[model samples]
Target chain A: MLEKSLKGNLGYWAWVLFLLGIIGVGVICYIVQYNYGLGATGMSRDVTWGIYISQFTFLVGVAAGGLMLVLPYYLHHYKDFARITILGEFMAIASVAMCMLFIMADLGQPMRALNVVLHPTPNSMLFYDMIVLSGYLFLNVVCGWVVLHSEYKGIKYPNWVKPFIYISIPWAVSIHTVTAFLYCGLPGRHFWLTAILAPRFLASAFAAGPCLLMVIALIMKRTTKFDIGRVAQDKLVTIIGYAALLNFFFLGCEIFVAYYSTIPGHMHTLDYLYFGLADHATGQVYNNLVPFMLSSVVMGFAGIGLIFVSRYLKSDPLLALSCLLIFVSFWIDKGLGLVLGGFVPNGLEQITEYVPTFVELGITAGVWATGFFIITVLYKIAISVKLENEKTA
Target chain B: MDSSRRKFLKIAGITAVAGIGAPSALNMLMKQEVQASSAGDGHGAQPAAHGGEGGHGAAPVGKRYGMVIDAVKFHENPGMAEKCIEACHSYYNVPDFGNKKDEIKWLWQVPFTNAFPGDESHYKKDDRTHAMQFMVLCNHCDNPPCVRACPTKATFKNADGMVMMDFHRCIGCRFCMAACPYGARSFNWRDPRGSKDGVPFIKKVNPEFPTRMRGVVEKCSFCDLRVKRGLIPLCVEATGDSKAMVFGDLNDPNSEISQVLKARFTIQRKPSLGTMPSVFYII
Candidate 1:
């Protein structure tokens, strides 16, 4: 099965080499950061977490999004999903791997990370996050590999693997919920204190995760003999449509609560993110994040609207465009806007802006390249095996 | 079932229970033994009834140390805050990174509006409150959010209610910095002992204190080492006035800090958050 990844056409090998080149550049940047400390990045005392942490948060949702395929197929016995379930599991494995790498890149002392395990503090949300993330990664790797192996051999998956599949359904939810707790449970951080944070995370994850899967499936359809039937693709678009709608509804609820309640602490971060907050003393306004945040809202609605329209949904290129829109919308919202918004008008009511250095950008690109590299290899194996199985049958 | 099989099952159950329970039971006993020995040493064994009146040798055990600052006195003395800040930084060997982005300070000052953000009053200005600046530092809160958020227990609350950091154990995750509502913690973004572009970050080295390495979070330990040696914190000593900055055991009613609280109207930063700050300001 592993040998299938080794046997690829010139184009496949070229794509793999391109990703490797990006990864190599990233490693060199990381070595510089390792020697110079986090000072090599643009993060400061005010904005303690920059791109690395934001990427980690967004990828957690993508990893948990794999549940959309696993839950419906396994629990409800939906056979329409049978052909593409392995794709979700493999994607999850890649996403979780990226998440762990992002966390490492964010740490000031990457080597001492094991201290969280050696001296585990049950009280910390991070402690629980470590447990759930690693557990989910383990669950996905075992479940994905074993199921794919059994399918390649043309036999029913082992009965023992069933319990793991069942546990994974809830484990996926735990990973994102714990990530939400890491922010929401903190004191004085008004932006993330809302009770709706976890639900919002899941909703965005459901929308963005499946949207990405659909885009990948469409790509596979064009590039290879793997056609994930029109029915399955349409069903996925439906799931993505409702989830994106819920995500926006939750955002509206947050806005309403912040404005109607009229608490200055609650409203100030929102003001800074959207309308720009004015310093009462100096009269200077900080509004760097306004354009990015507004664009996220605009793209979110436009993407969902396009997908829901019957005419556009019937067109493959239009649907792919819509999926890309929603995916990028959530990426900006969760990956860029959320973390930066929380830190602005920092604890002392002073605004300090963050801009990532070239080194930081290089490292971030490296992590993404690594994620795509893993995805390409895994997907190639799965597609090749499926095509072979179809020919024999 | 057969008698041999039943006997084997009974033995296995006992061994499994012992395997799970013996280490924990031993751990509990070991902790008690340490407590007993420390009590015998008289390090923190004295009763609160003794109080600060008994002088340095008779300092009370199981105490909640606190500080009281007279805002009016600070207003009268313009340069006093700078002096105190200087004393603390030098004592701690805190590095000067030469920029705000990487600056480290154990104590500092902020404008009245920034220090007490909840007070949004427009017309309540009086002589004492006019253009006021407050000295800010780690509150050493009774319910410290940093302690609850530290994944490695690197930042912990001591028996005396002081939030202390073990720099060696800190993974530099900065979660503590985010958890702290007061913005009390600072991370060593670069090596404090190292130089940059042929310029040294630390100009003068304090041989008395250990300079921290890069990639660790540090903050005021309430001068716990000095306090342990029966000396007050460096900042309090720098003020040169007993009432200007008072430090004593809050648990002891007869202590000077307790007396100051009883006699004056005091306020704390963000008291509504319920962190129960040990530092109070007399307005």
Candidate 2:
């Protein structure tokens, strides 16, 4: 397996090198941020969390999305997904790696990470998030490695691996749920105060995770000997299509509750996000996020329309385009809208506009580059074995 | 060696029982020790061990500390806020970044409406009819959301009612900032001790207080250091003794704060959130 991946020509190595180059840039930027503190970013006392936390939250959903395939294939015995279960697991691995990196980037003192473990508090939602996330990451690693290792050798995985696979199903839900609890349990941030946050996280995760998998599967199909089967792709698109609908439904539910109740506490965040609310002292209308959030809603619907048209689903390019749109929409909704929207009209009802600095964006790109690199390497190994197996057959 | 299911079950059972049983046993022993220590040294609510080590002195325990602010005094004097602010920052060695984004404040004044946005009018409404500015700091709540949101107990409610922070222990997650309804906490976006670009805002350091490193959350500890030495909080002492700011044990009915609360109409910030804030403002 290693030999196959290592033997790739100029293009493959260039791809690896390209990822490495971005990672190098990221390291330099991180070093600057580390020296100067969080001041290097645009985050302030008003918006304490920014790109790092938002990305961490979204990636938790992507990491949990592996269970989208795992549960259906394992528990429900939906065997169409069997061929691509390993793909979901591998995607989870990459996403989890990035999730950890994002969390580290968000920390004021990265070296003090172990302090969470040292002085654990059961009352803290963040404590639960750290626990579930690391636990899921471990489960994915062991199960994915063992299953792939056995598959490469043309032997069945040890019977011992089944229990971990079973446990991983519910554990997947826990990761995103706990992450939601991190925001949802806060006293004053009304944007995340709603009960819809966890379920909404799951819905968006289901949509974005599988949409990413479809794109990854398309890449595997074009570049490798693996088919992933049209049946598998269709089944996944079907799951993602309904999930996109559910994501929209949850968003609608949140908006309706805020509007109908007419509670300024709830409605103010929505107003700030959708239409810029007026600032009192300054008398200036602040709608910094309106365009981004409105466009996200529009793009999300457009992606759903593309998914259900029946004609577009048959065209791989169209489906891929739809998935890419969905990925962007959900990322914007959760990663961009959630953190900033949660903070605008902050605890003191003060509006401090937010924008990420170049250093912040560079660190973000570096995290994604790292995730893509991990995914590329792992897929190279898996695709090689699949191609070899096909040739032998 | 005990890999058998029955052996595992037996060990697990004992461990479960001990887990439930150990804490009370320890607490009972500690209560007796605390009583013995209190009798010997007049220190109340002192734990035998904190973070696996003994402490130097009296801990605020069994006493629920509270503060009553006379907003009218600050309203009349105006300059009193300046004195109190100066006293707090100098006493705490709080940093000054000269930029609002990076400013670290323990106690400060905002426009009156910002402090009581809900009561005066919507935060977006500009009306000077009920406008009044006053000093605000950490509420040190009975049900502090910051302490609850902290993954590590870096931010915690002391046995006394004060919300306390252990700076060295914080991982700088900033969940506490989101959790506090009062907007009380501040993150050291950069090192508070010195400036990187050579324009230093921290004019002097308080030798008695430890300055914070960049990437940690900090806020008022209700003058825990001064409190340990039996001194009133710096702000309270500077504000006009018991007239401008009252600090006393809420658990004691005879305490000045308790009597103040009994007589005057005092409002705690965001009491609707049920955080049971120790700090109250009198109009």
lDDT of each: 0.88, 0.85
Candidate topping TM-score: 1
Task: Assess each model's interface with DockQ, reporting 2 decimals per model.
Answer: 0.48, 0.47
Best by DockQ: 1
RMSD of each: 5.9, 5.8
Across A1-393, the per-residue lDDT of candidate 2 in tens digits comes to 556667776878999999999999899999999988989999999999999999999999999888888888889999888777888898999999999999999899999987776565778888788778887888898898888888888888999999999999899999999999898988777888878999999999999999998888887677766788878888888888999999999999998999998988898889998998988688899998999999999889999888766334478888888888899999999989997889989878889989999999999999999999998888888777767766787
TM-score of chain A of 2: 0.97
Ten residues in sequence with the least summed lDDT for candidate 2 chain A: A307-316
Report how far off residue A241 is in candidate 1 (Å). Answer: 0.9
Error in Å for residue B25 of model 1: 14
Model 1 clashes, total count = 0
lDDT of 2 by residue, B75-176 (tens): 777688889899999878888888889978989887766787666553336443245576889998877788788988898766666788899999999999
* Candidate 1 regions with alpha-carbon error over 4 angstroms: A310-313, B1-61, B122-124, B127-130
Q: Which residue pairs overlap in candidate 1's backbone?
A: none
List of chain A TM-scores, every candidate: 0.98, 0.97
